[model samples]
Target: MHVLELAKRRKTVRKFLPDKPPKEDILKAIKAAKEAPSGMNAQPWKFVVVDDNWLKAKIREACEREEEKFYSHTKGELIAWLNAKGFKPEKPFLSEAPYLILVFGHTKAPYWLHSTWIAVGYLLLALEELGLGTVTYTPPNPKPIKELLRVPNEWKLQTILPVGYPADPKPKYERKKLEDVVSFNEF
Candidate 1:
């Protein structure tokens, strides 16, 4: 598909089919993510791909615990924003999706966070191109995740991604125009 068409068609999918995606496709996306440039050639990103049902359930449980707290007390603009997206404390898709990619960053370097985020961007686009749907999520409490996944203390959880085929049609969301977002050399 053309780049522009792909860009226009891609959407953030939360509801996913139970079907497992091809491993080759997942690896391709990760390869693309790793191609992203990093500071001083230091590739400081690690990913944990979870496809097991039991493990996914554990992750969902942990995420829900954090989300429950966030939803009950969070109000005003943040609540309004979340409401617009139709988000709630329950995140069943975290387990429903066949793959959960746990993104991590090295604690040694501050620039690693930015590098990892750039890599994640590449991963998103690659997955979109491959017709796999994904959404980047963050659990309020990553402590359980660290313990459950046995992630080394040196690596910090950066994001959680649920990947699978979309269960429903993708929704087209409006975007800001270039003029609305861009500035001509001055803010």
Candidate 2:
């Protein structure tokens, strides 16, 4: 798929098919993440792929609590906005999707906090090209995510992404046009 088309189709997928994607496919996503540019070439990123049922349950439990708050406890328009984006309290996709990709951004990397996010963008775009669906989540108790997954202290949980074949192709969400988002030579 062309880069532009793949990007256009990519979104936070909340529903997944029953099928699991192959390891190689998952690796392809990692490859892109690894290839992402980092500060001073430190490449301060590590990916922990979790599929164990017990572990997934724990992460899901943490996120579910967060999601519940996001829906019911969150104020006015935020709730509707979240719903429009396909985020809901019931994230059944956590169990349905076989692979839980945990992106770790290392704090030890001397200079680039933003580079970690660049790597995530690369991974997400790459996964979309591979005909898989991915949903990025901020797991509660990020410290425990590493412990639950047994990742090192140097690395921090940047985000948790669920990966699998998509259950449906959702319509593209509205986006601000480039002109609207951009300021020509200066702000």
Candidate 3:
């Protein structure tokens, strides 16, 4: 499928089937992600693929704790929007998905955060191409998860992607028009 079509079709999958996807397919998506450009060729991104049920449970618990804190503090339209979207503090998808890809960026690298996010975009599209589904989930606080996963201090957590076949029906949302976001060399 065309890249734009694939992008349009790719939706954030919160509910996932229990079946695990092939490791080879996951690797292929990672390979595509590696092809993304990095600042000064540092390639300062690390992807940890977790499939262990125990680890997933631990991660889910940590995430839920942080999410609860976040929901309590955040207010106004953001909270209302989250509620309208059916998002709650409990993140069942974290444990329910067959796999979790934890993306990290080396803090010392130049433009590491930006470069890493570009790579993640590549990963998302690649997974879509391979018929897998995921959501870009970032906990309000990542320090506990970093320790739980034994990630080095130099590597900062970016996002967690829960991977599997989507169990929920796809949601339809509209995107902003190209003209609304574009510029003719001037604001």
RMSD per prediction, one decimal? 1.4, 2.3, 1.0
Residue pairs in collision within model 1: none
lDDT of each: 0.89, 0.81, 0.94
The stretch of ten residues in a row with the least summed lDDT in candidate 2 is: 139-148
Q: Candidate 3 vs. truth: CA RMSD?
A: 1.0
Higher-lDDT candidate of 1 and 2: 1
Q: Best candidate, TM-score-wise? A: 3
Encode model 2's per-residue lDDT on 24-69: one tens digit a residue: 9999889988898888998888888888878788888777766776
Clashing pairs counted in every model? 0, 0, 0
Best by lDDT: 3
lDDT of 3 by residue, 1-187 (tens): 8999989999889889888999999999999999999999999999999999999999999999999999999999999999998789999999999999999999999999999999999999999999999999998999999999788899999999999988878684688999999999799
Per-residue lDDT value at 96 in model 1: 92
- Kindly provide the TM-score of model 3 when superposed on the true structure, using C-alpha atoms: 0.97
Q: What digit string (tens of lDDT, one per residue) describes model 1 on residues 8-104?
A: 8788888898788898899999999999888876888998899999999999999899899889999899999999977899998899999999999
Off by over 4 Å in 3: none
